[model samples]
Target: MEIFLALLGFFSLGLIVWLLLKDYATPALAFISVSISVACILLILEQLGFGVGAA
Candidate 1:
């Protein structure tokens, strides 16, 4: 699971870079997209009994 998240985070960084390079999104928009996508994934994982807790 940790490995999966690590890879996801890695690709997510790449995704932001790609977006910025293409001028497809402002920095703020790219941040929002990545953050929201990660949040949604976490929610889905929790629903599937793969809970991750925040302290």
Candidate 2:
């Protein structure tokens, strides 16, 4: 899905940011990025009226 892909991209971007800030520690960056992306995707979906079978 387009939304899913966007979410993944957002997470990847966050991971990159984290890595930059933390000097390239992939593990911690990956976890924080995933959490941020999931939260952002859920929020966007809810706002768009496509969340939880509402579409």
Candidate 3:
């Protein structure tokens, strides 16, 4: 699980890098979108009992 999260984080950051490489509408939007995506991903994982508080 830890490794999975690490990889997911790397992939998320890489997505930002890719967006930065192109002419995205704005950096702010890209960051906001990715942040939201990460948040949702974490929440989903948590619901599946893979989060910090999971037993």
Candidate 4:
């Protein structure tokens, strides 16, 4: 699930960057969107306790 979320975040970030460069739109929207995605990914990791070992 962590891998999935990471991939999704990466894809979203890439899309935002592409749009910003191709459409010449303000990067503010892209930055905000990417930030939200990153936050979500972090939240998911925390909820899953990914850092804790599965003894």
lDDT of each: 0.63, 0.68, 0.64, 0.61
| Of 2 and 4, the candidate ranking higher by TM-score | 2
Write one digit per residue (lDDT tens) for candidate 2, span 1-55.
6876776678678766766766556677667766786676675686577788532
Using Cα atoms with residue i matched to residue i, what is each candidate's TM-score against the true structure?
A: 0.54, 0.49, 0.52, 0.47
Q: State the TM-score for model 1.
A: 0.54
RMSD of 3: 6.3
Ranking by TM-score: 1, 3, 2, 4
For candidate 2, the lDDT comes to 0.68
Worst 10 residues of 3 by lDDT: 46-55
lDDT, candidate 4, at 45:
59
Q: Tens digit of lDDT per residue, candidate 1, span 1-55?
A: 7755665676577566656654766787767667665665675466557857730
Q: Mind giving the per-residue lDDT tens digits that candidate 4 earns over 1-55?
A: 7666675677577666756664565678667666665665665555567633321
lDDT of 1 at 26: 74
Whose lDDT is greatest here?
Answer: 2
